[model samples]
Target: MHASSRRQTNCCRKPSTSGAKAPDLGNYAMSLTAALNTALMGLSTIQAQTGVTSGNIANAQNPNYTRKMVQLTTPAVGGDPMAAVVAAIVRAAAPNLLQDYYGATADYSRLSATTDQARQLAEALGIDDTGGGQTPLQSRLTSFEDAVKRLEATPEDTTLKALVVQRGQELAKEVNRLASQRTTLQSQTQDDIRTGLDTLGDATKAIAGLNAKIIGQKAAGMPTGDLEDLRDAEVAKIAGLVGVRTITAENGAMSIYTDAGVQLVGTTAQSFSYDSTTGTIRNTNGDNVTAGFSEGSLRASLDYLDGSAGALTSSDGNVGAMEKFFNQLNSMARNIADVVNAAYGSNLFNYTAGDAAATLAIDGAFTADPNTLDATRMGAVQQAMRNTTLTATQINPAGEPNGLSTANVNIFGLVSGVMAYHARQVSDNEAARDSAENLQANVEQKFRNLTGVNVDDELAQLTVLQNNYAALAQVMNAIREMFDEVISIGR
Candidate 1:
């Protein structure tokens, strides 16, 4: 309600001639008293304006606090049209710019998460971004191949024969280590997803609580500027986590939902939880909306786990970078075992028919006695190891077709290609991330300019209000002195 008051007073009138009817006074006369009341109203309004300016100055450093100003509205006071009230407090909020900032933030978060996770994968593979001749897997293959060639050159040399066995075992161990990293990385992805869900749930719940408070305060005719600022910050956080669309209610409440129409919050917030056992996320509605995520950090994590969304694979189905690299290592190991065994027309390496790369091992008999490799078949083994035109089928032929299935491709060349592919992935993603970062910064700055506070402007407004306040105080004093002078003359 507006701050106003009504006063009634008895008016003295001259006796009517010959007992005629007395003239009626409708209300208080519009004299110095009215002028004094008007000045008082002006002082009250200015005081409210100063309060708003003070708040703006106090919260100038607050990123979420938008600048506020008092809105004066003229309300009719009994037949007087000049009465004004501090009707409302207006905020410097721009809906369109805020929405744009939220959108840019979501896109940038997804891209950044994808790139950061992939970089971890590159590190796990021992894939330095530098474009050296070969990667870890490729280097192992080359060293093993060189050992085989040395054995071929001096078949009677026992030490060279032992060296070949040692090289083969070392290469197999490398494949085992890289394959293990995939499991570790996948587990890490799951933990990250759970952490993200916690933040999303907390933000949604806080927004819902704020919505309730805002509605109550608005109904009570109170200002909800601070509560609204906090709520908007939470909403922006949710936008980056899940990329939501917000709907504002008539009573200053807000509802949140994904673009697919799944409500995350109404008067009460919806609950979201992650189940590591099933590797899925379920909302309060009991629906798994993992695949429905379009853009956000959650979407990036989902893609990494599924190995289908943001994973880096070169036509090896829809596997991620780690899985793809594991497949390549397995294929190379089987090829090494199969080629060497076939060259000798005997089982030189102990690789099972349907086992993984970790199963590739040198035959115990060869490791025990190097003289066995001094046979004529050693020539064929050297030629097979040096062959660059080996087909995928010639290499292993038992497993499913994969990235290493290109025809007439050398094993070392395949490893080198994967290394180069990862290097390009890191480079391309970093470039895209930089672009997104710049765009996000640009839109955010524009949004802040429209809604954020300027301390200098607020201070200037404060000075002006102070001057008006001083003038109103002087007017009140002058009116007091005039009333006293009138009383003295009457005495």
Candidate 2:
């Protein structure tokens, strides 16, 4: 009886702690949800980073390509630490050191191109034989002039006269040909400018479209990285077409501007127009357009064609210096003939005679008395033709023929100088651009290290996710088994 009473008392005491605590179901569910989101976000980020890197590598060989990068942000969650969201790629932080490299490169390229062409043009004339220089133009001009001089020396020599006439005609034809080539180059430059403008317009439209898509998608709680990359790619293309300065807004939009600080694209798409006849590019309202290229190629091209180095018009309202040079050559040729005819009593050189009546007809092209033909005058004409009033209209205002008045300077000389400079610039910048490209590759590798997808990583994550799913399945099985046991016991 004593033992029974002791057991009863112990049972009655029944450990002061009351009931069993329920499992923290909400905490477990939240942890699993957070982990799942993290894994998904990581996968997305890795894929996006890979895409960006691949795009950069793909365009590595392209002269017009700019490198792209990836942007990431923390997803909006309180408990998740590993979750990531890919944001739009911000404009790359291209080093100004590289820009300087590019700018120098452009200057040199323009110089080289101009100089080389000028040298060739000089050679074409064949008269610039300060030494035994190999210039066809200068030599030919000298040969023609020598023939004229020889005829002057022996006026009765019909063979010499015929020779002078033949050589003169040949020299004239050559000068005309060279002038035509220059004109063609100018026309091509204009076309290039027009094309650049049209391209900018297209790029702007694409960028604007992408911006719209990205903004809308972001609002819908979708990732905007792909759309941002598309927009960045377009912007990079535009940079090659025309150097541009880009600014990023708080709203995740990018704005592009010209070197002159004119806005090209903003919230709305802007339009550009090309005038085929004038070979000019402008905004729809006809404002002269400036390039927004961060690199030097497009800017160099523009400078070569219409920038300060090759300005078509001056502040004083003068026409193109190059055009003026050609025109003056034509004028001087006609004047020389007129003077020779007036003084010596002969139409020895066929000059049409005046600005209106005495047109400069060389190789079937009607030009003013002073035209590009003057490039050959000194080599083809006798000393008498050298007599002239060197006026502003006759020569460049700076007093040399077309302002390239140095002793070694001639029409061809200018072209040579500019071309040479341009070539050097191109060579150096290309090297730097290559280096920058390499840096971009390094950055990409770093990015790959940080965020790129590895098969190993993917497999590991997949395993973790699979195991979690298996655990959930096992828990469900256990719960079902327990419920069955409860039913059996009741039965």
RMSD of each: 9.7, 9.7
Candidate 1, residues 356-388: lDDT per residue as tens digits? 234566788877876676556777877777674
Name the best candidate (by lDDT).
Answer: 1
lDDT of 1: 0.73
Worst 10 residues of 2 by lDDT: 365-374
Q: Which stretches of candidate 2 lie over 4 Å from their true place?
A: 1-133, 149-156, 181-183, 276-281, 285-347, 350-401, 407-491
Q: lDDT score, residue 233, model 1? A: 95
lDDT of 2 at 26: 56
Q: Per model, how many backbone clashes are there?
A: 0, 68
Best by TM-score: 1
For residues 63-148, write the lDDT of model 2, one tens digit per residue: 33344556788856556356566766533434343333333343343343334333433333343453545344445556766776
What C-alpha lDDT do the candidate models reach, one value each? 0.73, 0.51
